[model samples]
Target chain A: MTEMAHALRVQNLSKSFNDNSVLRGISLDVATHEVVCLIGASGSGKSTLLRCINLLEPVNAGRIWLGDEEITRAGIDEDRVRQRIGIVFQAFNLFPHMTVLRNITLGPREALGLSRSEADERARGLLERFGLSEKSDDYPDRLSGGQQQRVAIVRALAMDPELILLDEVTSALDPELIAEVLNLIRELAGRGMTMVIATHEMSFARDIADRVCFLDEGVIAEAGPPDQIFTAPSHPRTQRFLQRIIAAGRM
Target chain B: MGDTKRSAGRGSRLLGNRAVLVSTTSTILFFIAVAVVVALAPGSDIVGERFLNWVHLKQSLLGTATAPSVAEAFLLNVRMFMIAEAIILVLALVIALVRGVPGPVFFPFRAVAVVYTDIFRGVPLILVLYMIGFGVPGLGLGYVSTRSDITYGIIALVLVYSAYVAEVYRAGIDSVHQSQTAAARSLGLSRWQSMRFVVLPQAVRRVIPPLLNDFIGLQKDTALVSVLGSIEAARAAQIYGAEQFNYSAYVVAALLFVLVTIPLARFTDHLIARDRRRREAGGAAPGALGTAAGAPHDVPGAIG
Candidate 1:
């Protein structure tokens, strides 16, 4: 993985919160513009892994590289590194006090030092494209589950990040609202935005992912093309998880 | 006819069920309390010339506060409270920020914040007033010694109350969802920037009720400054009482403080109600373990 220059190269990443270790010595890589899906049952460390990569959750052991710069090293500018990698959480952490426009423009205006007009203009463009032009003046509390999630995506996209991490972006949505968000994710992938998605939407993962990684416990149990992972998972744990999904009529 | 009577029963002013029963019982209890107090008033000599003789009480109360010799000492009390409240907000917020600051670089400042909160919160306000008001001036230091005892009084009150307000602010800051901080940090905001923009605003909003509750306490504690011989409302009342041998002057001071505090307490209650409504209406993101931003002030024991 180190020999070739991947867009994201995570080596032996480990994370723990006090007594419980969530992610243990996991290594992975994603080439530029590749859509990688992390598939796991609830506590299989998928979200933690993505969070660790985003530097939201610091790794107890390991290294992460975004493009050529090693990000996990001491004295590294974490904010600078994070500006290049956007992340969207399942709960869609939109600032309730601010209007949607301000929420989107905050990163650009404050972190990137863009002028207000410039940030607003860019944010409006994203909002227009996402079919949310009318909602720009609205507060986050006024938004539906789906609208909020899309705004969260647009917020990340406003940074023009090189890589984006999505951690179950649709899990908090209503069944109907889920489609809007999934379709937006589909649009981003169609535009060849490099993304690492941690999701439970099996069919969507199958449709969107170039490579599918099945995590069990705290390690990647299997990884391959989506077809291989979805149709014929090699590991017993992966097979069992898929079997449950299929039995639940989600696959 | 029976159905009509049943419908009227539901809306009846009198002849109702538990609502009428409760209201009637409460009214009876309230009047009984009034009667008991009134019956005991003369026995306690409170109805006599010393307590509530209308003419003597009226003159002393009005002379001491309402139309005082020094711009209405009541006004002085109001002014002192307003200044202290404003300064305490900023000062306490700074101390809370310092106390919550991360990393070892701010160790000394953080340590100072911790010790300040601990000691000031532990010491009685009257003693603290004595220390800063009298003790500091006794040191005979140049800048420390002021001709106006009010300055020393204010400093002392600020020292003691900022600790309490800082704890309230800290509790508010802590009650803010951890995910809010994480979300801000993930957006490339520095720790302080995240706090300034995202976390602090939410924390402040959530804690406004409790913070105002503290302010109400501060407003009354402004009276404690009277110990320094500042001619604020309480001291003025005490002097008037000493001269007239009627404690009705103290009643004026009490009434003045109550007049200011009642509205503030009501506003605090209003904020608390609005906050609860907002939460129930789903303003916060769905919490991680279902309690990040949902539970408010569940861990405020340290502050008290």
Candidate 2:
């Protein structure tokens, strides 16, 4: 990877909640439009690292540079930084009270100060592209889990964000619905949307990610290309982790 | 209930075998009618002459042009209720906002909010009315012009009811999943924007039934404002009844209050039932993830 051509850089980042340290000395760099997948067990701090990069959770120590901008520095506006970087959660937190169209348009109209017609037009286009145009008027409660998650991705995309951090977007879906959300991610990747996804879908990660970072006990135990990590991970911890995943038939 | 009904059909009589349910119910109704007829008859020891005399008559049924009666005073009650309710809705929301404002920078304001909620909520509505309505005027503060007692009474009601309402709103806000705010924040909404545009809309729906309960309470308590010297329905009834030596005017006011409150109360119940039915309908979801690792909504417990 060309480090100077990086779109995102996190150098020696650390975060903790009440001395229960989550992310410890994490460091990584992502090139423009590169998709990096963080694969780890529940307590390995994959989610925390993503949250820290988003400034959702303040870091205990470290630096994160978004392109040429140092977003972690004090006096920097967090919301402006967030507008450029969309983050989607596993719960598909599309505003339940809002219809599908409203959910997608809110961020653009409110945060970005886009015109109502402009936001709605773009949101509708995204809705149609995602096969959710028919359900645009329906509330979040009306959508299936897969549809909600897809709409969530569309909501993030509506911002026209440079990077998207997806935190286990399909973990809550039923086994059958998981494929629907994963397919959407696959589409995003194909379109060259840069993303750092913290996910449990190992095969999906292995197939889609340009580089896979395996986090173990709050640090990256292994980082490599997909084939290397999936087939012949050098780190014993990465090997053991993939072994457990294979035993469970999750990969 | 089904099992009990089947047993009852097998002659397991709850009332009596000879007294069939329909005849027993009608006989009970007949006895109640007999009692009403006796009391309503020309002269009865159980009911006073004033009640009997005022139960019917054009003057009691509709107030006279020259006198304070239910018809004339009903508007006062409505005026107070509408104004207090409108003010309370806004004031309570402000109070809740002050109470829940984030960060240590607003600690003093939060403390003031806590004290305000604690004092007004505990001081009793009557005392608040007495203090603001009567006591404020009694202070002889020359700069403070004594407005109409009705205004002072409304202010007091807003003060006290707003405290109760603030607490209710806070509970509703607390019940909202933190993830809702998180989702909004991740989308680049400001803290206030997330709260105002996301959390509050959802919170308002949750607190509507309780807020309406307070509103109905406020409606009835409009009578309490009468003590502050407003000749609303209750006070008008008191005045008319005192002169007429009949309490039917008070009954008229009570009936009117019941008429207003029953519909509002039933509407609140309807909203609550609808909300619950929607929730129980299944996990298609309403967007709140309950802050679970995965949105643990329709599952009802921690999702595996």
The DockQ assigned to candidate 1 is 0.37
- Per-residue alpha-carbon lDDT of model 1 for A17-116, expressed as tens digits? 9989988889999998899999999999999999989988778999999999999999989998888899999999988777789889989989999999
List A-chain TM-scores for all predictions: 0.97, 0.98
Q: After superposing candidate 1, which stretches have Cα over 4 Å from the reference? A: A1-5, A18-20, B1-33, B40-46, B64-71, B283-304
DockQ of 2: 0.34
Itemize residue pairs with steric clashes in candidate 2: none
Candidate 1 CAPRI category? acceptable
TM-score for chain B considered on its own, for each of the candidates: 0.82, 0.78
Indicate which candidate wins on DockQ: 1
Task: State each model's CA lDDT, in order.
Answer: 0.85, 0.86
Docking class of 2: acceptable
lDDT of 2 at B13: 61
